[model samples]
Target: MRNLDRRLIQVVPSRRQLEHQQLEFYSFVHFTVNTFTGKEWGDGSESPSIFNPVKFDAQQWVDAVKSAEMRGLILTCKHHDGFCLWPSKYTKHTVAYSPYKNGKGDIVKEVSDACRKAGIKFGVYLSPWDRNNPAYGSGKPYDDYFVNQLTELLTNYGEIFSVWFDGACGEGINGKKQVYDWERYYEVVRKLQPNACISVCGPDIRWCGNEAGYTRKSEWSVVPARTRETELIADKSQKEDNESFRQREISASDQDLGSREILRDETDLIWYPAEVNTSIRPGWFYHEEEDDKVRPLEELINIYLNSVGGNATFLLNIPPTKDGLFHENDVKRLKELGDFIRHAFAKNLLNDAELAVSSFMRGYGIDNVREDNYLKYFRTDDGITEAVIDITWENEQLIRYIVMKENINCSQRVESFRIEANLGEEYKTVYDGTVIGYKRIAPLTPLVTDKIRIRILDSRVAPTLSFIGVY
Candidate 1:
């Protein structure tokens, strides 16, 4: 494969760019083997007949997504286990053979139609590794089969916002390389859904180069910077590039690893604006045992703040059951999360005097606070060591407590810290703790005086501390 020349590429508004501009969010409908067999779909083999969503309501799903403030939905058209959500003309192992609706309904079509009706974007995830297809192992033929299936998806579905092709390759039945004609696939997509963003290995966006939900302090926007340097680079490279070489704008996607244990090293390789994909349940798929595993509203808010607020988009997965139904618990949690997010951030902090950030002490870091300028201060022998910020009000405004925030770029341990108001002569020690790695901090407190200052005392490692803001 030839490297994409940054020059000849016209900066197009990718799906991600559109989403960002629209303040739109996404949903990952992870329904497949995991929903049917109550097991994760990694082995790539499952009975299509087992695929049934009796209560499947594409409109309802779309309505829920819209209600949740999401702009796009990505259905798991075909998972790694190779079960097709639609009745594929290329394979018998699909919803066409399923007992759901007597195998007469096409889930992808319903979803696409529903999304269009709701004026939202539609996308699909087609796993490259087909475990059940007998020809999957036959290298040359498998490529053809894959293309055929791709054609079916692209041609059959409505205008797709994205064609999610994950890099999950495995040995076919004949034990040959799972070779894929990506160029052919791209061509098909271009012909069908010309406006769609081909994800991961495609021309537009990459996989953060990592799937971790966490985002770096400095996130790259999907809208490529139209600089003279980029243009010159692209021109030089594209001149020598071949026809097979596709030139696409840069983009990124990300998902949180659903482990309870927090990642120690918070440096996620995924680029921003990364999409944080987390499930409402313990697993990505639905299971009887996981019916009660819905994530709490507060926890979901934290995820949103850290993910989307941290300069990454949030892709919250809510899997449907085998019966093609969302669990009541899941629905409740989703509603609660939506309500909490609106109530917390949507409300003007200037009006509500209830919101405040108490401690700006060491160890605590601010994750995502909006800023108009980059505040650089206190450069160390190595680099910048610490930063202090203060916000004051002139009149008695009906404002809530002030917020002190700092963006941590690298892993560091804090020794001590203090927060002081301009009112007092001496600084008062508000919070003192240890912040381990790269993370944003948001400290809330009761409304107090407007003037506030934060100071960091010590650190084990040094990372770029972006800025402090009062929100």
Candidate 2:
């Protein structure tokens, strides 16, 4: 259409990105030395003896994650403090020197094996900034050390789904920040874990601009290519010497990242989707004071909708307690969340409704919307961005929620749309939305209606919608 840059609708996600998006919700296990110190960031001087989780149960962690209806778990194998959960021969400041299992336990292996047995995907997060290593801040030596640690995790883990990184660079043991060999780190991941998607500071996924559980009203997957580089650089610049782990997230929260106006002059375009990460508690690490402070059910649900249901996937961080187990309070809220979701979408109210579309591509049909085929979507003819789909049933059906999905494999073209319900004589807008990338779970007030219609108000090109649901 126009070198794939001028035409935003033609840009699509890579295979790795596509598969990653399919995992709508996942868990982020943020357990490290920080869990013991009651601090968010450790200074890398903590003793290995303080690292033991005597009652640690990896299965308990995975079980709690599964109960929440999450698809995967990304463990903080090592944090910025340079405390490796796995026993690395390269560093004495690891679980190897810890008191757990008499200095022989490997938390990484335990969690990975538990995940494999539980039939859930496992991923790793190895911080690039190793404050405990003397080689850091030294040229090639630090790069070699980073590669060595990364290779160990990839080679040992059964099937790594993602490798999460952040741009938290601080003074190393030598008092100078080490220049990360970003390309080489990505290459190591590619060579060992061919199917894994590198996230945040890597290629496949982007951080959703904030860790406060906030999401853009219209999240776009096809942003300018420079976003990947500019964001990492920004993280380093916004860092404070006292708070080595925090970054200013709201500053990057732009309202229109991939609008037609923004992409018209861009030289490059990429399918860099955002991953909305937020901790269940106020902080990423467990503190006894925050045990009663687990996120409320309603707050978690809103984040789930705005993230996994928005254009981005949700990475909810559930930090483990000092005992290395998910707190009972956290588990209770997770159960409530899972039960609410399963019971909410238990049935699609539009199942038996008659379907009719105003227009469709030559080979497609209106019936495709009712089918479970994700690829077989109902798309409007060329240049016909505005369209409609009407549904009716013999008796009034109660619908509390509406779901819409764009066939983003063809690129996210649907910009604005509304779902209307005919409560009595005329139709009324129940929900209005924008940017239905991947998935959009729109909630509505409980209403009884036998007839409903979807109106596509605008789009950059002919709109393609893969799914619609009434719940």
Candidate 3:
């Protein structure tokens, strides 16, 4: 594949959004007041004195994350309990009132500094619901308080890559729900960190519709355009009278775009990618009882494949223990997962193989080209639907994974595909899958073969391939 240039067919991603998608894999640090309370959702009545971590080390946390091959870290600066990690002037119920460093510790500042020093990106997750704030249910006062805290984080921190918001709103201390001013919150993020992509309850990125670590089998990065109103309305209203509307929005947001032959709402097409977020353990916060329950190495790899390999960003939550460090078991598991991935994908078997396509267009015979800029096409006399590309290897080699990529700049075309390996002069089917969007890494059983062929079974148009590889 070489010397091919074409206009993008699908909705284009913003520079920030594209960079975010390229991150592929990252960890979410869910350390908060709940870390000490042993609760998933805290009611904000707990004493700040219980939040002391004597051996806290932000550098150690970042080092562990880097060792795991993750690109960045998203610190849960605040949760539904409204306990701020930083010493915000807005609330006395923060670390300022805690015993850590005699009320002089700032978790956000330390983590951000550690990230910058370690050369990985940093992000912030501030929950919209504040159960501790007395002014929460009072519209204008609560909005002002929330915005002021947001401004403190964005302005104080160096550069935040992503800003995360959850749909978890509950009744405040007054037993009345607080109406979050999401628009104003988004406005502040844009003004402070324009390069950051807002995930969930914001306009930039959409949730994968579940907390599980995998997306739909046929996940599509492109979906129907979302309006401002739809973007601001969190899913918390599902149990209220707006249940139908919430359900519809959720359905549309996570709609599987790979199964469609023709997107009828072409005019409304938008690049709203999904983010697969899941905890490293069954719970988001660290608990001593669940120390041995860290997600096994195999499960971590599977989660990576399903999320990052399935064309979606992955946010694996790795909660810090009460000691302000990753559990020894968690650190060991992350290292093992990273090592397995690095070794498994160390080299591509098809990088230098002799390549030929069934239907070559403009004398562009695929010579094992794997770069995204140089796309190889299979355009025939009668509008090519199905085409095969044969690769001749030097000798038999072990093949475990096959990575495929469509020229997504030209749109997601291939609907289904199959790969066959020539085993002793007899070709045998090894793998079959759907939707090769930006990238699709198909893991398969190790097979020894000297030659292999890939057949595109279905496509909306003559597909343009940017890469095809075996590892």
TM-score of each: 0.65, 0.96, 0.89
Measured by TM-score, the strongest candidate is: 2
Alpha carbon RMSD to native, model 1:
12.0
- Estimate the overall C-alpha local distance difference test score of candidate 2: 0.86
Show the colliding residue pairs in model 2.
none
Candidate 2 per-residue C-alpha lDDT over 312-424 given as tens digits, one digit per residue, 9 for 90 to 100: 99999999988888999998888898888899888876678899989899877777776545668888877787899998899988888888888877888887999899977
List candidate 1 stretches off by more than 4 Å: 1-24, 42-45, 208-212, 221-272, 349-471
Error of 2 at 163 (Å): 0.3
Q: What C-alpha root-mean-square deviation, in Å, does candidate 3 show against the real structure?
A: 4.7
**Comparing 1 and 2 on lDDT, the stronger one:** 2
Task: For candidate 1, give the lDDT.
Answer: 0.56
Q: Give the lDDT of residue 37 in candidate 3.
A: 85
Q: Candidate 3: lDDT over CA atoms?
A: 0.78
Is candidate 1 or 3 superior in lDDT? Answer: 3
Native-to-model Cα distance after best TM-score fit, residue 396 in candidate 3, in Å: 1.0
Clashes in model 3: which pairs?
A: none
